[model samples]
Target: MSELAGREVRFRNTDIALMLVAVLPALGVGGYGHLMLGIEILDKGEPDFSLFGVAKTLSAIVAALGIVLVGAQLRGRNATSIPPLVLRSLSGSMLFLLATALAVILVPRSLNHFVRELQPLSVLTEVVLVGALVFLVLSVSSAWRTGLGTLMGINGSVIHALLSGAVFLILMEETSWGQHWIGFGTPEAFKGNLQNETNLHNFYTYRFELVYYSTAVLAFVLLPAFWPKRLPQMLSQLGYYVPPTWFALFALPVCGLMYESWNIIPYQIWFFCGLLTAVVIGRNDTKLRMAALIQAALLMLSQLVFLTLGHNMEDGYELSEVREFFISVLIAGYALITWRRATGEGASASST
Candidate 1:
């Protein structure tokens, strides 16, 4: 009787309610895709099977998966295992980033003077990316101090170290070795580059952009949501950081808005609806629900501004900057959570 009662408490009618809410949006996704297809045919005199259209379709499919996953996960759990501080930090970061995006889109002229090369919004991208680097560095230190290297194995820190090095490389490449702010001229060798930037990424960007997007999606979204629970917990015990499924709340924007061509109302609606239902539903805590509501609203408003006005902006490249900023946020959050987990101060009260 006690076991049955506990099961009932964990999986309540509210869980079902949230699942239904999520299903409504999932149902609309297909019809919405068809409608967009019809509209494209009308406007272009044929269906758009171009690269951009294909990318958009792929994004829609993923968004649908996101909706379904969120619902399924919530239906099985009483409440999220995410720590209050971590959840709040993720929500606050999303709010701030999305708000900044909307402001930049609506008032491009205001930040024009502050913009640097590849930063159509402001220098905020660099600042945030640097912040991510700081967290990663701290994570490395925490891992060593906790003897994670010895605890897990001889090479336990291998993954963390490699990740930090990769991020550092990305930062240096993005900043063009400080040429963007320091106002230095590109060297003779790099002057021949297509963008006339000192960075090497520009030369092979098109080749690796897809790989970067795919890796981020897998690492931040799919792995957390779908991987077996035991695997992640085991990894955490072994000093490898595995993000909780709820991290998807913070990752949806990155997945939906990574590519400018894939940024549209369909993806935006999918993102907002998924986030709103996933965060607020199935949680008994009023404060957490209210916080989630506010963050969801900010995400929706940001998408609205982008779809309505920013989509038509002359420089599509600016959209990538937004994606990069969110990626930085993800990295920072992951590092913080990792550090906590490594030091036996896990963020979540409940086991993840």
Candidate 2:
């Protein structure tokens, strides 16, 4: 009984500590903005150099701590909520996001260099998307081979097949349907698009980008982190796919971008809700705690970088490209995880 009590105390303390770490970004950035700069929740004004500097400093500190925590996690335990392959893909994806952030911070003017359409970054993003498409297709095949459809009394291939189609569409958009490679011209109708590209997204999809962001939050963050264990398990038994909670961190950076209009109370709440949700989801799970902290750190760092750009960000056009790259990586990681789950290999399924 005494040992059990001691363990409970340790768990509580760890929860408190992790909670504080998760909210450090909000406290540091929001506090400084409101108290020192007198910026209100509804104020659309920009923070001065002092506030920006504080945000940058705080973000840097938290991001460094997150990296340290990741290193510690790697050293302390071989166990993780994420599959080995999935984790590797996520690591590479995060590197790309971080590299983009660094380029924006260190050389603000070089934003175009990293984000310009058809650049190396764009090519890399397409490659990842292709990889993801293949994985989703394979997942569908695996489902069929495993007879999940017959077992579940529904078409198991439907979900993943649709997912594959979605990814394929995204890939086509990214490549302008191979027009750049095939040397074809954009249709006259497409000439009115912002980029005048053959891609459908250039026409109007970018205008409703929040739809994409919101969908990601729902699929990756909210669903995975908050849904009960039985829910995912039941769905899996039914031939439905649910993202594992481990994905919240990888998805947080993209989710964080939704609130750049800092003056908007709703957007702030949106981002913070997701932030807090990720923390709550990880409260007791060791692997999830690591994931939440690392993701929260990236969240802070991304907020700082983009906020500083402000009006100059051109409605976050360039930043969106970087995020899309991250999203592609995330999708690939998800496909990997899904494949593992279907095959009953790798890490066990996660729950909140």
Candidate 3:
């Protein structure tokens, strides 16, 4: 009983600390970003460097807390709650809306409204506002069962942190300090990281980064924790090398279609991890693994489908985009079939 009591206290403290850490930085720096824009509103109305800098730093700190929370939560068993879930959604939404309102109110009405050209204040505003919104939506739609886990799901908040960091780097460029801070030409720097096939001027700055990261938070962070045993089982029966090849075939071309310059290395790493999970799960209870794999694949691939359509132009987009879609279907579908096949009586039903 004493041990049980200790565990309970620990959970409470961590939860409270994580929750506060998740929001404080956003609120604090978000306020500063607001102040910078306010400066623009008052004087001849130019962007304020000092205010923007302060805001970005704080915002990054807050988002890093969120990532830490998510990672820590993932290490435990599935645990999520209704109140925490709702609060997470609210936090993301409120931040996004507040930033949007400030941008409209503070930034001059005549500065060509270039999302790319917006000041640092404008950049941070965009990050928090959109970052929150993405997390909110992802959290609400999640299948996470624990309140804490749900709030910190991979798709829940970690992806938002990644997106927030990307935007921070881009905004820093507008100031001369972009070099001093981001190392200017470092491989991780905005220019090098975001320089994709599109050569988009604001690859890191684009609002799409918000959308991409939000979706990713769901895929990379959330899916693994919930993966079924059957998933890992199937892959093991067939052996390890095959699944990675299969996953790569599907993930790569889709990356091309999504066009967001996502870290391919990271994406591939996660895919193999998911596949391995499927194999492990499949070895014991094939049914559980198959179901988990399908759900995960659906959530991840479905998001990519939306993004691909939205980003790609209709003019010359090739039919090859369909290949990734098909490959996802193939891998996930096979798991379902094998699970049912191994389960005997459940085979046909599972396949259907």
Per-residue lDDT of model 1, residues 1-352, tens digit only: 1122233223357655655664454345445655765432112112234655555555555555555555445332233455676577666767665765665576744443434455544466667667777766776767677765343355535556776788888778778889888889899889866689898877766545556655666576545543333323224353145466466555656654522444342433345444544454324334345555555566666655654565345454555556666677687677666666656576453224
Each prediction's TM-score against the native?
0.64, 0.68, 0.26
Task: Give the candidate number with the greatest TM-score.
Answer: 2
| Candidate 3 regions with alpha-carbon error over 4 angstroms | 1-13, 35-51, 77-212, 222-352
Q: Regarding TM-score, does 1 or 2 come out ahead?
A: 2
Q: Which of the two, 2 or 3, has more lDDT?
A: 2
lDDT of 1 at 49: 47
Worst 10 residues of 1 by lDDT: 39-48
Candidate 1 regions exceeding 4 Å error are 1-59, 62-84, 97-101, 108-115, 118-122, 149-154, 181-184, 232-239, 263-301, 311-314, 347-352
User: Each prediction's Cα lDDT score?
Assistant: 0.55, 0.59, 0.33
User: Positional deviation of 249 in candidate 2, in angstroms?
Assistant: 1.8
Q: Model 3, residue 288: what's the lDDT? A: 42
Top-down TM-score ranking? 2, 1, 3
